[model samples]
Target: MQTLEKPKPKYTGKRHRLSKPELLAPAGNLEKLKFAIHYGADAVYIGGQHYGLRSNADNFSFEEMREGVEFAKKYGAKVFVATNIYAHNEDIEGIEDYLRNLEEVGISAIIVADPIIIETAKRVAPKLEVHLSTQQSTVNWQAVKFWKEEGLPRVVLGRETSLEEIAEIKKHVDIEIETFIHGAMCSSYSGRCVLSNHFTDRDSNRGGCCQSCRWKYDLFEDARPAEAWISEEEARESSVLKNFKLGVTQLPLFNEDDNAFSMSSKDLCMLESIPELIEVGIDSFKIEGRMKSIHYVATVVNVYRQAIDSYMADPENYVLKPEWIEEINKAANRPLNTGFFFNTPDHEDHIYEPEEKAVPYDFAGLVLEYDEETGTAVIQQRNYFKPGQEIEFFGPDGTFFKQTVGQIWDEDGNELDAARHPLQRIRMKVDKPVRYFDMMRKRK
Candidate 1:
């Protein structure tokens, strides 16, 4: 038999090398936006006053969005505005104008879950790229293909998707694939939970999620009907007890030690799997905390930035640093887990007990301005810091050193023992020189 060589793969399109995946960060406000980019976020996603899911975030006003976009451009970073609410008829009222405004402000992209909002954007702001939000619960390659056909250039896959599934999706779909690599994990399937709406009348779909899943529950049994047990306070508060009636006794769902966090899922973390993620051809790695503190944004973004750059620079010699892991541990609010990335999470992945481990440090202050002549740093206090306390200062360069606060002065130049007020602007003498936007945190 003659051995016939397989025909060379037909080239319908030119082959191109995949570029470095973008490190996408969250920006709840302009301050967070600036720091995220400074710390090495390739792009930042933010919410506006309307139409986004983070109703509690200090979202941008139009003027602020314009300024933020301009500021992001200065660092060669992009800003994506979230208009991802599952809109009702009333919610769609001002969206057309909002889309136009976002385009005018030069937003790099718009994230949407609703078809109507996407259609409106295509009509009103044809220049903006539309990204399918994770709220749409896109799991399969077919759904991604459908979204691509609908004109979206990117799709944020649902949180429950695995690495194997993501690789499969990448093979089938040509559109950019974005997935959450770090930060809080929702208990409900891709954030579609009715508990928040049912318990608090706050629709999780339309930006008013109360996180009902994270609440502790006590199962109670009543001999009388459920209505007899409902008190005035219970009625007013929409008690969870009323939603589910039990018998004659009461049973707490968790042990005494575990009651505080019975339903709380561990936060997602993937620092150890960066190489595998890259090998799988993911287009973007998203950090999911638009409502998190600025310190959280800065620390997480900086560590991930360093990890990505270090691995890209020399993949063969790459070694995960202990310090990088330390930084992440310090920044995390809950226990960390791999989420559903490696395998489906079990009971062990959920935190049933309170987070008892103290944070390694507390965010002390932010250096607003540094005067080289006076050797003084004008600081905005985030937490209480007293003179003589040892604090570590770290910034964009990722260098940190311990320094003692020798002296502190008020805005009036009056001497002070402690910076006690929140957001108080004070001047402090530093033994080591610090730069603008440098963060000070008290060691625990």
Candidate 2:
């Protein structure tokens, strides 16, 4: 590759210390929320049952949201609630009540997209800080400044933005800038696609997205199987004589195929670029999976936590653990990319098939009870754990240590070959101290 030309540097820009930003993960439900906090998240953003995007996600209830806020605070982590859905007249009616409740719950911040919600939050949740969600499409300094003037404390810039652009935007804007450091990539611009609503009446803005972008397709025209699409699976299996373009095209009468783009872009992995992001003046690094499993949440949180800590210890010579990258791959991911961070994305960056295949290294469970006196730890396994298998333990402080199992005993003190049953309690001895939220796994 040829060396690219450099742009002239602007001398009049403001500079800021680019320390490690807060690692923000997503929590679709209470379990995921708790797992992210315990594993290593400095903060987590979640959508409530109403007003936010991600309608299908297992959102928090009033009671759960209250507990979630308290739970995160207990661990010195902040919680931001997303109230970012575009509003209609009906949505505007209950805006005050929504903001008032969020303020009462002591939420760390409110992620807003709609102007009505922003206006309402200022009056109703006056004490609550507001962060502009990426759904608002603040891609440049001008847009970010406009939102900041409206009292937003922070802004999540668009996904398509490059790292250098973000740095430039940071130079021009005074408010905090948060960008998605990891997790799923939306095919549409900043996740504002109307494909779900246009195709299935499920509003993407209201969070009922059916993900039409990832849908499979076969090109066709004139209501007959053309030479271009004759070999398509749908055309071959059709009981109806008429042939039509399948997936993201004009709709036909029988839309039998699951053209919902169910297998979307794999989650983004940025463990390798944590240092670069910090240098770009990002104030918060956001993770994008709220509908993920607790194990998924825990693994991702712990890996990123370790990555950040490693960078802080030695910015110049920090080397991310090979195991940490391995752990991220163990989570749900598509082909990994530096993404727009590198300013150029290859064709392979977009995944068309399935994401990464499932691995056996699922999170087993927590070390619920430990008896350092007896040199044994009581564990509640979320999945099976074979005796003699080695695993990484993520401690309460997010410090990781390696351990090999020696003996396994059931809850009743009977010898067991392995902790293979779901949610089963087992007694095991480790070489070192293992705290709650410490994870164990056997890789495939």
Candidate 3:
């Protein structure tokens, strides 16, 4: 028999981006879920305490899961529960029960990675939508078609795919492709590396990643060791390894700089390239932080919501404000890059720095009741709202109103220095009408 080669697909640019695809964001816990809804996520994805990739983050309990779903529902935002981690046989034993409960609670979707779990979801919660998690490393049209045939309602495309590749896949496939448009990027492809597991027994897939890949190391050669790794310089200079590290120890053949393939890039940031993504036909855009605080959630969500709207409104004159970028940076973030969207994957994306020191910003309160006619807002601060500092009030329609703090009054109309307790309701005057779920923040 004669062999024949498979034809390479040509880029004819037939398919284009959706006019208005869903904006999906990650919610590690109940509060962030609220933030996601408030700031303008069309849908939010959360993980139960088990069977998710982010295990160590403050994940939701079953009770919290119910509340999270309800919270998202109130604002017309969908909630997708993640059960997307790779599982062993034992992990599958009680899977049906979990699926049943999630389905019963009206979860919008159940994201899964393992084919077994997908099967389980289909069999147990046939009514529930199944989204294929990116952990599956789905890159090509064949794999995309196979999963769609297997009954996945959507697929969270791998972070490693370039914009052009994504558009190419969209042309060939009819199924929806969800992609991580912003937020963090894994140093490795689709976050399927064992560096964290190998070094610290904390598997990232299992949700216990210690992030040893982001740790500083020294290069060693037969007892001789280089003190530190310059990731930028190394990435630009070396072809053998794009990401080089300093070896913490010296051994006969253990050269951390040369031998360590564990070097992954820093996380990805693609806020500026959103228009490019929209032009590329992405069905859904995902923000990648569940471990982050509610403030982080609110800021990123608000910025993206505005950006998406701005682009949709008038892409010809669409200009992202410098303030939006600054707002994103206020959250805990690595050095930013466009990821593999524009150029090839480079080692420069890796976080060579030590731990990120966050400039403190916390969600202080939300307007529970607002009387626009009276111009008075009744808010419940999540934390103590110390008076006298200027605070930002993020309203429902993406209008950020800043007001100088004045006399804080209790329900009795008596003034106080600060709302010094969690869930403390305080009265404040607003220049304009504030709606329910509108966020008020005090940056420390």
State the lDDT of candidate 2 residue by residue for 346-392, as single tens digits.
Answer: 55666655444664466776788778898788888887777778776
> For candidate 2, what is the lDDT?
0.77
> CA lDDT of 121 in candidate 2?
86
Which structure among the candidates has the greatest TM-score?
Answer: 1
Q: What is the C-alpha RMSD of each candidate to the true structure, in Å?
A: 8.1, 8.0, 10.1
| Per-residue lDDT of model 1, residues 1-444, tens digit only | 975984332222222333578999999999899989988999999999899998989899989999899999999999999898889889888989999999999999998999999999999999999999998889999999999999899999998899889888988989999999999988777656878889989988878888777776655444343564457455435445443343333445555554554567889999998877776778899999999888889999999999898877766677899988988987888889998898998988887665667556788999999889988999999999998898888887576788888889999999998999999999988767888888998876
Can you give the lDDT of residue 296 in candidate 2?
76
lDDT of 3 by residue, 266-303 (tens): 56678887777777778798888888877778788888
In order, the Cα lDDT scores of the candidates are: 0.85, 0.77, 0.77
Cand. 3 Cα-lDDT: 0.77
The residue-level lDDT of candidate 3 at 3 comes to: 56
Please give the distance, in angstroms, between residue 395's alpha carbon in candidate 2 and its true position after superposition. Answer: 3.5
Residue 82 of model 1, lDDT score: 89
